[model samples]
Target: MLSSGVLAGSASVQGPQGEVAQFEYSGSMLRINAAQNDGYALLRDGHFYTVGYNNGQPMVFDAGAMLKGFGDMAPQAIHGDLGAEIASLKDTGENEVVAGIQGDVYEVQFIDDSGAQRSESLVLSTDKRAQELRDALFQMMNFAESMTPGQEKAKAQSQDIRARLSSLNAGILRYGSEVTVTEISGEPVAAQRFELPAQPLDLQGLGKLFGQ
Candidate 1:
């Protein structure tokens, strides 16, 4: 259920040292500004680009190449699915409020391609406003997964999760201690928001700096 208009939101991801990464997203792009880092990523016409600052100057690079290089460096073959599929959801009979919206809590069980199981609690809202943000997020995720190599299984898994969530007529407010949605709004984002600010620096040249 992709939204016909742009939607924006603020979110945070919990990390070690109690750190949080700030995120802002529209349907077509996602901007991440974290400690010591600032960047935005987008997929256009099946090409992925990461635009960020280096020495306070804007630069763009091939995100897919960077990810593929990382994949090749792995010592062992990755086994489980990168995106896990939800196996079940059970109401916890609890409720929580986030960003001024109330939601129901549910315990969600997930299984990876390797049959590995894990569980987490999620706060989900059926609020109409949240649904718009959820749809935008789904679009962003799809673009990300499509650009990564060898993500076919993971993509399918992600789609299943989206379908399940939609069937519940809910949007996620919080997922365990990892992520939380702080605010959401339907706004028209400028097209320039996704445009690269400067010409892309060749990945080859960038790698030379690190002697890669």
Candidate 2:
């Protein structure tokens, strides 16, 4: 059930029970090509990429949610969260966690799971790439405000500035080797669809329930 002007893509995952897992799109159709056998899916639109992987039973992980989990950081939905100033790096608490200060660079710490210990700092940048990106976006917004002046020259300049800002930025930063980028058109994409059909319940059958 994909919409027009969109594509459908899918990926596979190896399950513990040796069952075949399929991830299908129910909204926009994604075209997948030149795939490897490493259970990875990467979709690209120009320089931007959206990636996801199949877990099992056609359950494809949401890219945004997976990004948050892998980065161990939340998206800047609110105004004052650390995400507003610095991007979150997915650390999984297995090795590190990211901390940020507004208008400054971000740092990572190798924190223990119990939150009782921390290792040395790992600074990502010095000039604050997050804040720089924010500023660039705001600059484009300001340029767009000029369109209300009713001046032809100002309007042209505003359009030029907006395009420059957009082209200058390549979208969100990425981390980790397992992450994949997907190509998606500008539209309301579905989160992901999945179902678990009913099957017989018994010990031996249950052992093979996953197709063992």
Candidate 3:
């Protein structure tokens, strides 16, 4: 799941699936700068868009609508009950250095496919500033993810997420499949980035375009 894809930066690969993928984001936006095309963007504010070139002309539209038009072909949604998903958190008390930062280690223990318990270590800085960094990002991301379907259940799970964030007490410089997370820049992201660049072409008559 590319659920946390926004923060992943540029990547280049050479293989059968070789392509270049880049990401840019604020709290509300995520864009995948992909090869063979400009890329796509997913907005938490109920919008999705794809960018492409037509003799260098820009094309951006509501991707969520496009995906919706796919009906059953829309990507399978992956979800979990966060409370039932985790067995428990175990503090390893181990320390590791990442990008010249020292921090304590903790594990998010859970069950494997075989139904056996397993764990992965996550490093969190003890520095107060680092903790603040973690807190702010966690808060925003928590609110965003909560926007997914399952409102009542989501509300309950979001509470758990917030508590976990507070206890973690540091910005996650890394997580499962998270490429790289640098320090917080405190920069203001433009809200317009979430808006569609051009008037969207309605999918009603555009089935052939998207292979629907």
Candidate 4:
């Protein structure tokens, strides 16, 4: 078992395409430094903070109204044939071992908005230690949602994930090109690290920074 101080690690994308795509990133591709609130991000080039520390109301500020654009880059599925979507999923009941940890693997077989069928693989932790880490991360995630401006809808989706996790005896540790948490440590982090960046650069600066 690990302490609840701070779980920090990085996971470069794996899989064939993932390896090729991971080349562009430098440091950690994602971080969970936020402890009690949702992290913030610019909406493409929009003038508001679409994703941030919302608290059940319109978190409007001088920048702009942080209207929810689906919480930036959330991985769970959303509207548009949610019923049909769930019906299309296929659980291969396949399991794989990675780095001495056992996990269940599954794939999604769904027709995209462009009418193209896409299949994606995800691994769920079955290891006891990994399960504890998954719970900790889930706690942090719920903290973010609890701050949402009227999080009823978002909370429901979050609950769906939680329910599926236990019911299925698994929780997602990685998804697509976005999230992929592997190791967890108990390093202490300053409270200030959980807050938003003092000065977030615009999308243009980000493009240049990443050399895109």
Evaluated with lDDT, which candidate comes out highest? 1
For all predicted structures, in order, the TM-scores are: 0.73, 0.19, 0.54, 0.44
Off by over 4 Å in 4: 1-90, 108-119, 184-212
Cα-based lDDT at residue 209, candidate 1: 39
How far off is residue 134 in model 3, in Å?
A: 6.3
Which tens-of-lDDT digit does each residue in 1-212 have in candidate 4?
22333444322224334331111111111233232344432211223332344454323231222223234322233222221232233467888664356677777554544556666666777554454455544543443453233535445545655555566555555554444544433333344333334444234333233332
lDDT of 2 by residue, 80-125 (tens): 1111212223323233222222121223233222445332222221
Model 3 segments more than 4 A misplaced: 1-37, 42-46, 65-84, 99-101, 112-114, 125-162, 176-179, 182-184, 189-195, 201-212
Compared with the true structure, what per-residue lDDT tens digits does model 1 show for residues 1-212?
65445666555545435566655566556655564557766555445677888799988887645544543222113222224777888889999998788999999898865789899898988886677667756765655554345546666776776887788878888888766666554454556666778876556444333324
All candidates: CA RMSD in angstroms?
4.6, 18.1, 7.2, 11.2
Q: State which candidate, 3 or 4, has the greater lDDT.
A: 3
How many clashes show up per model? 0, 16, 2, 6
Candidate 4 whole-model C-alpha lDDT, 0 to 1 = 0.41
Q: Please tell me which model should have the higher TM-score, number 2 or number 4.
A: 4
* Native-to-model Cα distance after best TM-score fit, residue 156 in candidate 3, in Å: 5.8
Give candidate 1 misplaced runs (Cα > 4 Å).
12-17, 42-46, 68-82, 112-116, 149-151, 187-193, 202-212
Give the best candidate by TM-score. Answer: 1
Question: lDDT per prediction?
Answer: 0.64, 0.28, 0.48, 0.41
